[model samples]
Target: MKKTIPFSLLALLLYLAAACSTPKQRVPEQTASYTPASQELYDTIARMDSVMFDAFNKQDPDKLKEVFSEDLEFYHDKGGVTDYAQTMENFRTLFERNRDTGLRRDLVKGSLEVYPIVGFGAVEICLHRFCHQENGQDDCGTFKNIMLWQQKDGKWKVTRVISYDH
Candidate 1:
């Protein structure tokens, strides 16, 4: 008598076959025509970027604090990692140092990208430049910045930041 394959064995084989299938790798498009998943989200984050940096340019530490979460994590290429308190203190010091000439932050035109994070608020990627008057001339540095925004109680704040490539 010929024996037939058991149902359990067939099910296991099917499961194994499905498990062995490769998953498609997801990568963000790097083209000039890249678009955000949500235009409203893009606009909101863009506005937040402008407002946050405006406070920074104006040397308003308190205003900046409003935009940064209490659990903020700042990662800088040269200065290393910093917590919320430390980052705030650093900004205060920077403002004091540049009190005369003053520092300004400008977002590179068409460099901003916003991506939704499901349950979280969003992620913002962009290039920005910080400029200051130095020796009767404008001194500037451009850098790549990534920010994770968290929305709670109808308010949004930056939870994490990666500032690099200075």
Candidate 2:
């Protein structure tokens, strides 16, 4: 007596056999990414940026401290990756050096741009000009930076800085 095999079962077996016999092709890794803009988020980051940079130039460590996450990864193009302590130390040195100089970093007019990183947080791209009024000399220069602000536990803190373009 001959046994009958169901059509669905036979088709599935044939498909599996064919699939198993074929060589698998490698899939290329995705290299494209997109981030959208958030105005409310921009307002928040703008406020945060003001809090951090203004206080920074004023040498207000307490106020400056409030804006950055403890695990900050500040990467200055020239200074390399600096952690919290190193950044504070650099700030201290900078503050000490420019105590009476009126050293300030001002965002270039209309250069501020913000992009949301979905759940991570946001990214700010801007050009800034650093000016110093020391003695009888007032000097200034422009630069650009990309900053990453992260959100954790409902609070947003600056986590990274790709500072460059002096």
Candidate 3:
């Protein structure tokens, strides 16, 4: 009597065939690294960053708003992405909530690195830490941020933000 192939064996063979039939390889492309920003530029950015964060820590929306571009795009790992208006709304909510507890953001010392983007503007890579006090309890954590700063209307404005690595 002739015997038929087992169902399990046939399924395994089919799966193996499907998986092995495709030869897939991911080739990564490289681009030139950004040029380092000049000291003067770095100093200017640092000062601007200081002002920006000071407003955040103090929950001052006006000061915080001035530092950002009207076409700002903010990306957060936990909260997703938003445009300038949404970001402002978020800031308003956050400021209202954390105003009493005194939320603060501090850049890790020597952790900020700046790069020039040839023509448009510059990029800032930095590690920042946040701390806040609430309900007689203290909480804190550190995260990474990549900010795209552009010059517009004769002043520097942050156009984009990538906040991640919590």
Candidate 4:
């Protein structure tokens, strides 16, 4: 004698079969073309990088503050997190303490990933921090940086910066 399957079991099998047969959704790949406005924004961000690097090398707190948003957040390699005001204060204190100290950054590699309203940049940087030590040595290392930028008032301003040694 043949046995009959329950109605609920048959429905479950049909649902499983339909789900298995459906194709998975795919994410679109990034393309190279950029809109005119996006290109303008990219150029502005690139220029901002130069300004920021110059401020860092010069240890100018006012210049650094101009590049950063009012609600900026900074994550440092030495396990320290700072907000905009705190970061600016720290830079001021450092500049006052070591008047002769200097720092420079070299951009090794960088890329910008743009979204609808925001963009993120990944940069590999080499840092050289010099001070008048006993042996006159310089602290040097390579670090990977991730920066988040947002378009505000027709310009791109850095909202967050995170860096770690490479």
Candidate 5:
């Protein structure tokens, strides 16, 4: 009887030891890599550029205002650092001066650069302007835009924009 009890106790200890020693299913460490093929991420960045450019071409101050964050800051070529309200006001003034002012975005290029948790993009934009009131003169200028974007809650949002003429 004593021998049997000892054997049982040893078996129980062995079982517990084995159970605790069993290696857990090793989970692969999450690596931080920018996979460009991710359709959702690509679309998010593309949409941000599209909306921004569309607002510019249409001269829709309201839409443009909505695209930018409340605390957005813009550094323009001619204009220095502009706050959100100031930028909107500038656009409004421009639109008001020339009701027929039309903008054509040409040769716009964009690229995405990713970091561990954040990313940014550099965009080259060619601005073409046509206004009948201004003698129908066509104006052309090239600008380099550096925009910082962040992924928040699976959505990409532009936080800052800095542009300078080349």
Candidate 6:
């Protein structure tokens, strides 16, 4: 006895066969929107920034030990790249050298932008001015900075830093 396939099954098989024969095009990656972060996240990052920079302003590299990750990557425009150890050492030397002169960093008003990184912590983009005593006058320079903060075990630390536009 001869058996015949059902019309619906045949049509579906043909459609699938045609679909399989066609070349597939890859979809472009979709980037997240640049929306403002939640107020809670913004506040948390702001506080963290304060903590980290406060240590810098105080010339206390020890305080930064908890703020930066052990495998931190810091990229500076003029100074190039520095790992965690070198970065910390540089900070120590800078702090020691400028201890008496005093260097202060102030965040430019309305220039702070915080964005979440999904599973990671957040990205902080801001303009800060560093001021120091030069020739008995305040010498300040404003620069752009991008910091990648990572959150783990209920603690936040900066994992990468991109400081440029000096």
Off by over 4 Å in 6: 1-35
**What would the per-residue lDDT of candidate 2 be over residues 14-71, giving only the tens digit for each residue?**
9999888954322222244423367798788888888788898888877777788888
lDDT of 6 by residue, 26-111 (tens): 22222444446598998899999999989889988999999999989999999999999999999999887788777988777667
Off by over 4 Å in 1: 1-31
Q: Tens-digit lDDT track for model 1 on 17-136?
A: 988985543222346877889999999999999999999989999999999999999999999999999999999999999998868998888789999999999999998878899999
How well is each residue in 80-120 modelled by candidate 5, as lDDT tens digits?
88987887898888777766655545323333432223354
Pairs that collide, model 1? none
Ranking by TM-score: 1, 6, 3, 2, 4, 5
Best by TM-score: 1
Better of 3 and 4 by lDDT: 3
List candidate 5 segments past 4 Å from native: 1-40, 107-133, 153-155
lDDT scores in order: 0.91, 0.80, 0.83, 0.64, 0.59, 0.87
Worst 10 residues of 1 by lDDT: 22-31
Model 3 ranges with Cα > 4 A deviation: 1-36
Steric clashes per prediction: 0, 0, 0, 0, 0, 0
Instruction: Report the poorest 10 consecutive residues by lDDT, candidate 4.
Output: 122-131
State how far residue 142 of model 6 sits from its true place (Å): 0.1
CA error at residue 96 for candidate 1, angstroms = 0.2
- Kindly indicate the candidate among 5 and 6 with the higher TM-score: 6
Candidate 3 residue lDDT tens string, 1-166: 9999999999999999988887332222223444445987777778888999999988889898899999899999999999999999999998888877869999877777787777777888887878899679777777888999997667989999999976
* Model 2, CA-based lDDT: 0.80
